[model samples]
Target: MKLPKKIKRYCPYCKKHTEHKISLVSTGGKRSALKHGSIERAKKRGRGRGLGNKGKWGSKPAVTKWKRKTKSTKKTNILYTCQECKKSHGQKKGKRTGKVQIENKEKKK
Candidate 1:
């Protein structure tokens, strides 16, 4: 399905509705590297005995057939900055805090 070019989303940091730029995230170089190298090795090793499934009864899922580990194909809206605070809140999924401010009550003797 064709996706929208821009979407109005609520930014928690901004605490209000903000315009988010929507674009398909291209697969990074790291994914290509893993697909071309390590993934191939894992698939080759996983097929033989001693790795697993030597005498197992259950059938393995077809999704596991792909040698390469697939990343999220869904499109996501990433916020570049906060609209209300006018701060650069990058698209990271963790709380970011600054150093605590301290006040000197008395001078050291």
Candidate 2:
């Protein structure tokens, strides 16, 4: 969806209204591989090696990668940076969208 690059919003730090910049917040980084209780760590410890039944870690029928189903859109967040205080804050809830664009200004209708 199209959005304005700058918006007049309430700035809690400044305790007043100010122009804020808009930007899309990207999804966070991947999880740590060495974290406890991870499948990789368990396999490295020889837990799933030479076992009759690996229980929860047991191998199952292989499925094609393309067969996996996932949501077309992702939950995205917007960051608003206050021009006065230079402080940034995100929305209370995320918006699900396939695409997001922050234009310099809204087109005249």
Candidate 3:
């Protein structure tokens, strides 16, 4: 599905309809550097105490470590800003729930 570059939605802060620009936000470069160092330290620590479970038993769940295959994006909220009111409101992505509809077919006798 193609995501909207700009979304028109209700802004509670502005109390009106607004257009929000959707873009991928990234952490500042400095923060990324800091995270890199922290991850390296964590890897080093894990190597010594078998914390990462890399070399542990391959088949056992107990030895398996949960790891994210993909890095998490910094996009936290869907931002809306009213053009007339010039006010903004942000809603977290997790707050929205999706619904799945199933169609039922009737049999003819």
RMSD of each: 16.0, 4.9, 11.2
How badly does each model clash, as a count of residue pairs? 0, 0, 0
Give lDDT tens digits, candidate 2, residues 4-96.
998889998898999899988877776887799977788788766675766655464235534676888988889999998899998888888
* Candidate 3 TM-score to native: 0.34
Residue 40 miss distance in model 1 (angstroms): 10
lDDT per prediction? Answer: 0.44, 0.81, 0.47
Candidate 2, residue 99: Cα displacement in angstroms equals 0.6
Ranking of candidates on lDDT, top first: 2, 3, 1
Ten contiguous residues minimizing lDDT sum, candidate 3? 94-103
Identify the candidate with maximal TM-score.
2
What 10-residue stretch in candidate 2 is worst by lDDT? 57-66
Candidate 1, residue 80: how far the Cα is off, in Å: 7.6
- Which pairs of residues collide in candidate 3? none
Compute the lDDT of residue 65 as modeled in candidate 2.
33
Alpha carbon lDDT at 31, candidate 1: 53
Q: Positional deviation of 107 in candidate 2, in angstroms?
A: 6.5
Residue-level lDDT of model 3, residues 1-109, one tens digit each, is 1345556677776666676554433223555433654544555555335445544332233323545334433334444556556665555652222322222333244
Clashing pairs in 2: none
